[model samples]
Target chain A: MIVDLRRFLERRRPLWEELDRRLRAVEADPFARIGLDDIRRLHDLYEQVAADLADARELAVRTEVRDHLEALVARAYALVYALEETPARFRPLRWLAAELPQAVRRRARAGVTAAAAFGAGVLLGGAALLADPSARSHLMPFDHLQLHPAERVLAEERQMRAGGDLAGEQAGSFAAMLLVNNVRVSLLAAALGMTFGAGTLALLLYNGVVLGAVCVDFVVAGQTAFLAGWLLPHGSVEIPAILLGGQAGLVLASALLGDGDRRRRVDRLAAAGPDILSLLGGAAVLLVWAAGLEAFLSQYHEPILPYGLKIAIGLMQTAGLAAWLAFGGRWAGRPAP
Target chain B: MIHDGRWLEVETPEGVVFSLPLAGPVARFLAWQIDLAAIAAVATAIAYLTRWAWDLLPDTVAAVNYVAIFVVAAGYHMLLEWRWRGATIGKRALRLRVVDRRGLRLSPVQVVLRNLLRPVDQLPLFNLVGGVAMGLSRHAQRLGDLGANTVVVRVAPVPLPPVEHLTPPRYNSLRDRPHIEARLRRAVPPAAAVLAVRALLRRDEMDAAARVELFREMAAALRQWGALPPELTAGRSDEQIVRNVVDSYFRAPS
Candidate 1:
């Protein structure tokens, strides 16, 4: 116990001040490279100040003094014993080739679940359209989709033949709109995972219903080639990107449920956090590519860009994407046995 | 970790415990409002700065502007909180900080996840969902905070109480009776002693009559505990007696 508060403060004040100064310096520049000696010094100061806090809590000093020491110690502790890795310089190529695919493969079960949800919606939508044909209005919300697929295909081809620019000078703006809208939807799907995947599943199902209904509408109207040429270029990437978003949501939900895991809920969530981010980041990148293709290439019809060539391009992209995700990071860290 | 109403008491691996004050929903809401205004201000500034570009290549400028605004809106909190160690512009303004629930360093994924989940917390407008969640949560966590394993804390500075002003008189009657001084120190709890010292430090802020009554009650308590002789306390005022007792208790024995 402190017999003389003034004397104790006088003696310990310098160490506290030093710790405070060092903490401020570190906090001021998060990316600064601290030398080994400096890191050791910081650790030492933290222990000393933490000891002081314990002593102060023994009622040796006023509450304010104890509080000050506690604050100082807390700040130091966060820095000294941080659990997360230090921020490293980002390398996009390495991330694309390795981290992105690895993250997806880690949560393959969730991706399958997401695909199942979308597939169920597709089946239901297709069945409903085939049974009633009037459900198209409800399934397809867009005004353009309301047009008879064959008529729309004819109009699109005629416009191309007449040299009428479908997107014209507004292609850039349209691409930007698509990028913004798709990313927002993907993020929403991921965020709604907090509701135990209900909202996420519903969003995926709705998107699938629209896709299924539109495809059926075109095929029934003898516009299968037009549909494939128009959608495959962008949809190959964009659809998968949305499915990735759904995958992220399912991953978040599984983490929350912790079905068989024994770790605490927060720990599970923390563990899943990085993978979710990677999934979302990967989705955003794919959406960017999809948006550009959709706005510039997918809008054109047969006379401008042959359906066969477009189909070939789309098939090649799908094959490449499948191969990459399947084997992108398989040998990243294998030992030379 | 223990959540005792307003404070989160965290025990470190070394067995040292510290408490962090939790920020109330009202303060958090105000901080969010400030952040919204900041976003709006940035959007407006971008519009003005890009006005010249709008006239040059209207389509390209519009496209760039759309993407830029969307990025700013989406990235503002995530980027700032990541860089500032869980403080956005508004959080810094209000002296609030987002901290890991376990008092560890804030992680990048935590920052991204929390911001991404803001949309769910903001369901049906005006953060009704987040507000209700905060009110019901033991640690005042919204859905985003829960998902991220984070909590917002108040980091207001604690000013040291001025003990020097409670200097004992040259001829202190309490010091003359060292046994009674010892008794007072032993009887009085540390918290009570601190409260008495704090009262003296902020005596100027209290109302005149209230201050008098406060000191009277304090002095009576001290006297009862100290059991000083009548002659020793005969002519001393309540404030003076309280000050004398504190000084005697806190001062080192000569």
Candidate 2:
């Protein structure tokens, strides 16, 4: 099917291009005089887009690009009424082509209560971090020491082994603990979305700042380069995922605080569907990665990487994010919806 | 929003404004909330500028930020309106706007009052009790809009499409629109009959598609009828020229 479509395209490329160009011209004007011509052009464009989408899907083109292109065609169909009489009406429908953002926003608004709850969660996290001087130094109540308590976690690992093959039992227990703990943290991060957006910001900030402080403390304790062989296996994806979750939470909080103008606030809670899915997927992967580091590398207690290197890496990540947000190819020259 | 009877009206540069029937508590509250947010954004920006001045840009940060924000405020309003005219970026972007008491534009004085009173109308509480009240009111006007004699209303853009003569031997709306078969079914009499057929079939397709086909045929029909002005039919779609002629009726002031 793909091959046939490709051949058809190649054979008809000249005609298609001409049709596309003509339609584009009509789309650009879309006034009354040439309504017949304009509709002809639109018909031509639809056939072309449909064929391209089919071939692109076979080739496994990036999902976002494919989605956008498909959306553009459908959008063209939606507001084409304006084109009916004035053909000039094409521009407005042309503008309204992508409805995903609007749909997402409307869904979000529908779930306002959930959004509000998330917003509240973020506020709690932020307040705790900003108000608490000891937050950085103290155990998070669920981190390495307090929950596990002086190798209590390790002791529990031993019990599993006694009932079966010792190493296998211990390993299973280790994996279970890691999974459970990571789940709690991820949930915490998402929930901290309340208190407007400040809560989410505070959560991310606290995590980031604590990591920075702890690394400094560990190094001073002379476990120099503690992370070189310690965190490499998972920290890369895990830490970033945590931050992503925090960002999602932040967005949720802001919406609850009545972000955007009335027209923009179509819906609130459901707005986070895509964002939530993305965050969850990212966080899940990072959690596994974090587990790998804890089990295989973190236990080794090697010298940490140089502070300067860690700082540099962190800064680089931040720069990359800024670049993605600013000049990212995702939006290109199009104004964000 | 649906209204049954005639109401008071105000004219302005933005669009026509209608006084929402009667003021109510709920509308009043929502309006207050709207003001409250506006105040907060402005205040927060001001506070940030003050801090930046005290710490970051010692010599001119404060002045720069102040002027920059002021210009931004006015520039944003003027640019969106002069270009889009019907709505400012915030209103258009947010899907809301300020117009006359009869769904028209707010006058220059109204604009100044509504924007300038941002501080008094918006701030002073960690909560937004007043905003909710404004929203509950009929007019959707906060203190500023009410005092300034301006009305705020939801805006819908004029969707001007071409009015064209329809053409057809007969085409199915569900199927792709058939291209003109080059060989006419017959030389047939005047061009008017072909258009009449297309328009007749159009009522069946759908509101939107019908509009498109109608516009297309209308122009061709007009030409055949010898009604279109020569300048308009020079090259562009007759519908476009027609649209421009109609849009002139509601454009903002120079």
Candidate 3:
């Protein structure tokens, strides 16, 4: 049976328009402006639209008519059901200041475990590098090994290390690559936590060993001071950020582990939703800063800038970051009266 | 020919049913490609602009470019999804919108969670893992959407149909008595009312016996509520009486 859309629209348009207007008004000002009357009207209109949409389907109505009604009803449905405005946006800063620290504190056990595992890897790698020179080649990637040669490293260390004279295009690409790689590693660490956290642990171990091996390489090559000047500026923030990724992975693992027999594993993951978000969010924020430091200060040592000043700046940055994490959200998590 | 994916049926407290047409993998992939292209375009623009500015502070180029790329890659989705009601530019272009699976407003936490897991979804290379997960999932939701309890729905505007005008015989006897009208409206399922209208519109198509049986069944059901007044039913045929009652109920005020 053919349904006359034009005829049907002439009769129903007024009701649909009225409903649309009311919904628009309520959406615009959700507070004191919408009274009981508006709510009732919205509800009534939503029901009407829903019924109309169903009828349109059954009657084989015009596609345009069906599409228009479907969208209208969907909008009305969302507004009616989602009346409570969840103020979740415009407060990423708050998430960082309050929620992130609280999350780290709540999951301190996991964070500590991650840190310990990383530290163990570092120590093991450092010991191996010191004992056998071959371990240095094994631990460092080919590109990394290429970055600094033993002879060139020593030669550069003899003079105040002038930063590499990279062209604008080269520097831009380098920066992009660095940021992408760092964030990718961090996200990978966090995601690998889904493998019951063993993957996360392995990544942490690998990273720690590489870092430790590189440190030993610098020490053996007599570039400890240069390494400190380069790493400390960004390492102060970057390492913590990476650790946060580790913490995130551990949190995922914990969620899986913490699922007592009663709840589903997915439910446990859901329960740990905030912690996961906080860890990931915090890590991303830290990575942005680290990227900035590594790209700018670590790469560039102005001819006049002393190594002592760089070391001092790195130290200060590390201390400041530590203090912020320790006390960032001290009072925000308190129970409301 | 758009092959709409699976339908998710949601029944509201008011007994209204909504059948949401879920977006399929093909549409979602296209949307992702659009977003990816947009991000790349923005990154390229920044690369050129950064190159120009880097001559003055060459060492800071990496830092500046790093931030520029990061913001474009990650921040684009978050800001647009949150502010534009769960639609990225790609999603918007495809007429798709992300909505909470349970019909709640998409919260900030959910947005962040979904986007953060994006890299994970692109696991190993490309979005192979995500595509597989989406294909296997009930709602065609990728890992992030599943984790965040959200779904992307295709939203097409459905124009309202004109009301059916069956000129009443002077007075809608049913409408005259508000109590009985309200009771009948409440007791009758929306489907039944729609069926009644369809039956009236297409009576000629049905065989005489089938038509009689259909109205007899409907009239019997309508009377079971014991709200039909004698005046409205005195000598009216079962079909006419049922049609009048359904019409009056539809015309009732909010």
Candidate 4:
């Protein structure tokens, strides 16, 4: 059948133009709703355009004409069929109450593995430090270790109790500093999980080893009580947060290792997406709280409180964190009817 | 045409087949370059501000500045990609944006995964891994895009060819027999139809002899598809008959 090109263009142009204009409007405001009538008209116009696009397959359509029609059809198809995402209200609160614990539970295997790796590092590091006192300088920077050979333990404890001359600005900066540092380490553990998760394991091990080495110093110095007073204030929360980050990374690696075609693997990876987000977000929040405590309470209160009182407060803080993570959002998980 | 990738055909649940023209690596590379420069600029500005803050603060805070820099780098891509419909500043400048393979808006997790794996895509140096992946992949996806089930596509430039008037004829004899018309449509290849349409539109610019010769060739070739009804072709010239065929194929009957 002989089809007239000019007649086809002349007859179909208005429909294409109308569809194009409406699509642009829709694109501009993805959430905007035109009247029901306009929507129906737009849908009808889209069907007609879709038919024209298919029919254009037979006609000697110009490249420009085909391209124009193709773009129009694609846009219309997306608008008509694309699922809309409902805006999430109170996302952080929702995440904390419902998603966090669920994600933690889902990634428990990875979390256990992470904790084991960290514990091994601590064991190895403490052994290494106990065997050689000189190892402390190498394990941490000299400035960070700050172990004055000439100073007596009592003098150092007094100085620590006094706390650094942290002015208001310095205190604020100290909090920011700790928050950033903790978050960075956590993210690195998680992000590097893309490396088949080996990097995550290595990072966890390194952090644990350093911590173990630091603990050895307190033991050798006969200041285990002081160490607990300083670390327990925040370490209870901070350590778990870091372990969760490592777990998040391991989940990514597992997703990558999933057996399938690339599409199936991507689908698998997407399935793990919520867990990763929840873990990372929860860790970030915990790190912030840890940073605040490390800045204000840990450094300042260590000297004044009796060792017994410090231990009690530390146990309470740990218990509070445990209870919250285990049971924060009881009602949020139920599906709305 | 130089960097054109072939169409990717997908069948919808409703059985409609749609084709997306896959973007080529060259355009993707150019877009990446634009993004790289934009990111670098942002990093530099953040670095300057953070450095000033560090100088005033205690030495303990100095190390944290590096963490801030890392956050800026990672957050820049994730936040913009998720919130801005998958276009970063550079992607916007290059008129390229990331889209889900199924033509849906990108979810937050997809954005995070894609951006997080960017370091993997940049493995070694200068996007070697990403570029190679794009070259080899069917959809020209880098590892990050592949992992995230996303593809970057060129935004169609607008305003699409000016609207033209639709003048449906009072009667189209060919439309009466749907079976014959369908066979005819199936017979004529889309590329050939496009050539014929192009020729007809530019016929005025063609030499009279060439135009006549072109129309005769097209009309002769088109006849092989099926016999045309005499009612539609009784008094038409070969050129007129070709135009009728093209129009009949494009326009649907009421």
Candidate 5:
């Protein structure tokens, strides 16, 4: 049936083609205010012409009537789309676009809400892994790594801590690399997560799982409380930072799926303008932050700060992000580029 | 070259001017927050209700508790899609919807696909993988809607019917209703177009009743133009014909 409809339309292709040119001309005309009435008339006429086409085997083809119908439909559609798109030609976020703020605000609220719930789920998932010794094993494979390098890296890290060169540029350099690597990993976890949602889930799950497993691995390997002490220096901030980045990434995915304020919808990705940069920018910041934490602070270790202290910093970092977003009330009001 | 750099120019209901960029991380973040809070709250409640049911009934019957909770959760999701045509809590609070690519309601198959994929999309790692794909995809589809061939969009609680005034005067008479009723419907299609008609036509009735009568006429006018469903009521104030469809049907008196 659809093929037949196409063929029928094809028979009048010349007329519609002519009408299309004419319609395109009017489409940009400032006065073309296609309204619901126009669409109605066009739709009504379409049916009449379509019915006549169906009866072409019996009745003579009324090319003129078909042409008129085609023209009307094209005209109506053009007018409606034109009126809807024209104002946007000048200023972005025009007066009518002002509603976008409220809309965006509402969407932001929704994102926060989703983040909280997801966070809660993460906490619960964390608890679930902790409770199940076997499940904990699956999350962090490094936990059970009894490789000689584990001890070597552990010893090197310990030696670095005692060197007291913490104030040196080396420490800063180390921190930077750690931050960069960490951010990249988180981003990798997020960016490479483009493998459909499964990869993202795997990235997130494996991360949590690895944390759980590695934590258990450390504790079981006679690191005792010292094992706890080891991760505290950076894992606290690093882990949660990665988690936060993932939250942003996930939110992007869900919204990408369609949180439709026509102007703010995911369609904007392909839509032409500076807005696409802004859209990608939001995600970029997450990657950058994740990277910074991984590079600069992930390696911080002083007997002065225990696992508990580092963990506190991590928790604080996460909390700070929540507070910032809650108070910021517009995606952190980043300075315009 | 004709298009702007990034976002495509779009015409918002109030006529805002900006390229319509796809909802990104920031926008998505906000949308999820609003959606999950309600879903979690409801899911928790359903769990509690079923938990209570478990205690009241026999083990075999109590086993039904799990099924009961599932039903409520699934049913809530389904019914809202069926009725409001969006996620229940999100739709009511934020006035959004899940629509086909063409902005029509989802088919039953689409609904099932969206809901079924929920468990997967909600998997650990923040649906990170799913999100990137959604962002990159041409349709901006998440895993659920990707499977379902649907996308959730912010819907005006009442999407107004297209009312264009650019074309030549070519108004058609009504086919749904005949005689004086069709005439009245044509005269005041939006119900709010004429205050005098609303006030003077039936002055003494309750506001609701009078509004009902007003919309009935409007609905008839809408019928004349074309087969306009309630979807047109989106994002508009004068959407009574769509909002109170069953009542408007009776009120039309044609």
Candidate 6:
């Protein structure tokens, strides 16, 4: 059937323009609240334009008008048929007290796997160091870690006695460095879940190996007290934060692998996105706290800050973190009287 | 879910189907380059600002710079895509947008997840992983896009052709014979008519010789299908004859 293309365009141009205007307003400010009347009007306009598009498709000849109408309908369809709920305004307190922990708890299996991976690596690293001391260079690649543990402890004690301010002016800078480096690693661990979790597991294991070698080096040198004082202050929080990142990656991998689930891969990944993001966010926050502690407190030795006080603080922080993850959001979903 | 390597076709519950053009990897890579430059520029600006305050609190200033740069680098795409409805500076400039694979509004989680996974996409240097993934994927999605269930689409505006171009000429000989006009509409294929209209609209953009050759061929094809009278085609130029045939094919009885 032949359409009077000129008359059709002239008659329908206003409706198309109005729909375009409303869409631009909504697109300009995603959070804008539209009134019921406006929403109904928008819906009506969308249907009209959609019908026009259908008519244009049946035109005797294809023209740019059809393409334009399709684009319009495409935009309106996304807004009108969006199935997801509107995002709620961000509340830091609620996120911290409930959402973060709840997401972590929901993915407990992935978390366990991540922790197990790290633990296994730590054991392998410590045994390798114990059996072959000459392999220290291979096991721990850091220059600072290369120093003999006993000699390093002696130097730290000497510095403490001489009133050396090891991190006095540079603590802030050090914390910033730690925060950037740690956060990047954590993000990478989560991102590598696209590798079917292999990359994430390998990273966690490698980190564990380094840690295990360092701990064994100090313990075997008979400086366990100094090691505890130096590492526990930050490692308690930092280690778990990295593990959280690994857990997020594992969750992504599980979704990709699907195991016994029948859903398509895309659907599985979509379902896991929120939890992965939450876990990553929690890891980032914890890493920030750990970075500050590492820079400001972990660097101080016995003379400046007693080993006993630091150990207690580390233990308390660890306990507090454990409790938060275990029970923080237990009552979040409870109905009020 | 039908994809022809260039377009992704999505069907709505209402039975209306639309196609979104998938952005090629080269375009995506260029957009990334622009984004990287934008990030570097922001970081440099922050460094300069921090330098002025370095002497008073060198450590603190340096620390703030580090945090600021990291935030800018990481948050640039996420924040902009979320707020701009899936467009970053680079995307806007390139007329590309990150959209959900199912043709739905992008959720905040999807935005954050896609950008967060960018590090993996860039692994082993220069987006080699992402480039390969885009090549292999049916919908031209990179690894990050797959994880987030998103795809970047081209949003270049398609201009509506002027109505006058399709308007039936006032002195058309075809309009005098109603039976002939009806037969012309049924005889000419929709594809041929569309090509005729497009050639007419973009005639100015073509080389003069090519334009003549194109219209001559199109007119000849239309005549074979349309079977217009000798008197109607006797004096009209090839371009004019094609235009008259298109007009009759599209114009309704008044």
Q: Which model scores highest in TM-score?
A: 6
Which tens-of-lDDT digit does each residue in A1-337 have in candidate 3? Answer: 3243334566677888888787666544435455677778888888887888767764533354566666677788887776555354446777777777878888898899889888988888888888897655678865756555466455544443544454333655565577678888888888777568898999999889988888878877787777787788888888889999999888888876774536766577676777887787788888878877776677655353456778898899888877777787897774121
Give per-residue CA lDDT, model 6, range A249-290, as digits (tens).
999999999967799998898888878988999999999999
Clashing pairs in 1: none
Scanning candidate 5 chain B in windows of ten residues, the lowest lDDT window is: B159-168
Which ten contiguous residues of candidate 4 chain A have the minimum total lDDT? A81-90
How well is each residue in A123-196 modelled by candidate 2, as lDDT tens digits?
55445545663564462433552332224323543543444332322443454456456644554555445345
Q: What is the TM-score of chain A in candidate 5?
A: 0.45
DockQ of 6: 0.58
Regions more than 4 Å wrong, model 4: A1-5, A29-42, A62-64, A83-90, A131-138, A141-143, A146-163, A167-169, A259-263, A301-311, A330-337, B6-9, B22-72, B119-136, B158-194, B199-254
lDDT of each: 0.86, 0.42, 0.74, 0.72, 0.44, 0.86
What fraction of the genuine interface contacts, i.e. the true contacts, does candidate 6 reproduce?
0.74
Candidate 5 lDDT by residue in tens digits, B1-254: 02112232232232222222233444455556766676667767766756655544434233344344444554566666644444456554654456555433455445543554454465567766457657776656676665555665442222111112111132222224344343444443343433322232233344886666765565565544435544444434333332333223213243
Q: List, residue by residue over A183-273, the lDDT tens digit for candidate 4.
A: 8788778877777789899999999888998888887777777778777887887898899889888888888887343557767877777
- Candidate 1 residue runs with Cα over 4 Å from true position: A25-41, A60-62, A83-89, A334-337, B1-5, B169-173, B183-195, B220-237, B252-254
Tell me the lDDT of candidate 5. Answer: 0.44
For residues B119-197, could you state the per-residue lDDT of candidate 2 as single tens digits?
3344456324235435654565554444344554443222111112122122312122112111111222323433333
What is the C-alpha lDDT profile of model 1 across B60-153, one tens digit per residue? 8888889999999999999998888889889999989998897777888888999999999999899998988899998899999999999998
For model 3, residues B9-113, the per-residue Cα lDDT tens digits are 666666656667888888888998999999999999998987876668765676667767877888899888877777887998897888888655587777877
Q: Candidates sorted by TM-score, descending order?
A: 6, 1, 4, 3, 5, 2
The residue-level lDDT of candidate 4 at A304 comes to 55
Error of 5 at B230 (Å): 61
The model with the greatest lDDT is 6
> What's the i-RMS of each model?
3.0, 24.7, 6.4, 4.6, 21.0, 2.9
Residue A106 of model 6 has an lDDT of 88
Give the alpha carbon lDDT tens digit for every residue of B185-250 in model 4: 788887776666667666766899998999998987876665776666776677776765665666
